[model samples]
Target: MTDSGIPVVFIHGLWLHASSWAPWLELFRENGYQPLAPGWPGIPDTVELARADPESIADKGIDDVTRHYAAVIDTLPRKPIIIGHSFGGMIAEKLLGENEGVAAIAIDAAQIKGVLPVPLSSLRATLPVFKNPANRHRAVSLTAEEFRYSFGNAVSPEESDELHRQWTIPAPGKPLFEAATANFSPHSPAAVHTENEERGPLLLIMGGQDHTVPEVITKSTLKQYRGSSAVTDLVEFPDRGHSLTVDSGWRAVADACLDWLRKQNL
Candidate 1:
């Protein structure tokens, strides 16, 4: 495939290893884009190592992960198109706001500072981290049952278990803690530059059945960018859950993204 000279950066959210983006990277490359999926700071290169030494990623917060990706962008040949999921999605928005990317796609991103709706399911989904305040400074691993609830709820139990076995890893709790308290904090790392009118285009993708980040959260996120004249769009997958990006139907989601990028001429 001839190189398009366009870079696509994939950012994974909590509990999923960066390698989970393998399929997307291959697909994007075949379509002429240079795609890279980098692990979060302190993250091991592989899922096994990341699971074995969760402590290496403990205590890392949103700002830490954001800064890490920002540094990664600095090394790229050109400003990449940032595509992120969960917390990674929020980080992508922050990066785009700072003029780090040519555009961004935030898929089921975590809530930022201005979002106020906290759905009960969202609370239950994150109960693993919130149940113990100490988790804020530790790395927390989810059991298969918990993963089923949080990330695989909309998928078949069998497929859910398989996804858990393949990609689930311990994730830092600090980012969740920071997001939970963002609205109350004057200096929350969860804050994004939604007011930046000069930033590049942004697309917010939501999994309608997502227990972790419901559609309401994504809609609220869109509202935050209303004051800015920058291009911001929203798309929802009503039948999908948090696992949509890695599940069987992921190709559809990825195709939608590619279609959108083409529309933007990027």
Candidate 2:
């Protein structure tokens, strides 16, 4: 399983799995990049199956997910250029912090431990899981309405419904709980190594209309690494929402990412 070309690992966020990255894979391959999207451990192959059996990923924590992605990267002949959305974005940053990837892009990344500004919208977006203590040890599934509020607010109602049908899945709740208390936890996996000198170039992409991980949250995340020697930058799409990765305007976001990667010579 040795690969020669530059490998790109696409990480997906919650409520969606690796199959959601099919469009991204095609686009990257057309540009001569090798794209690999590994689903979170124990995730079902399809949204229907995942919705039917949510327990597979129940209780999975941030540490568990990171280690799963790290194992995949370890098998690659060259360090990859990692790109992720939402929680996947958080994982991308974690991987960069660990010096695993050559470069990384995180779109609407959830806040790491050190990022302190938690907006009301972010709180609301995660309320489905965080509001209930029992969710800490169980899997959680989003209703269509919840998905619309968290991810598809900026898209049309019809499109939102379609997107929900195509990509929504059950997600493990433990990671949400871990992230919610990251700052207080003595051994929080959500804590990032923003000051790691060996960290690779990193880009944090934000959607201005995103209720889940808004610009304020992303800015706070960027500010966390200001003193670090690693090249870190921020890019914001004003009209985009949390669904920026899979929305109709996804090409614009993807092209922006390509441009950034080109600038880095990654």
State which candidate has the highest TM-score: 1
Could you tell me the TM-score of candidate 1?
0.98
Model 1, range 88-204, lDDT digits (tens) per residue? 999999999999999999999999999999999999999999999999999999999999999999999999999999999999999999999999999999999999989999999
Q: Indicate the residue-level lDDT of 162 in model 2.
A: 89
Those runs of model 1 whose alpha carbons end farther than 4 Å from true positions after fitting are: 1-4
**Residue 193 in candidate 2, Cα distance off native in Å:** 1.0
lDDT of model 2, residue 262: 88
**Model 1, C-alpha of 38: deviation from truth (Å):** 0.5
Worst 10 residues of 1 by lDDT: 1-10
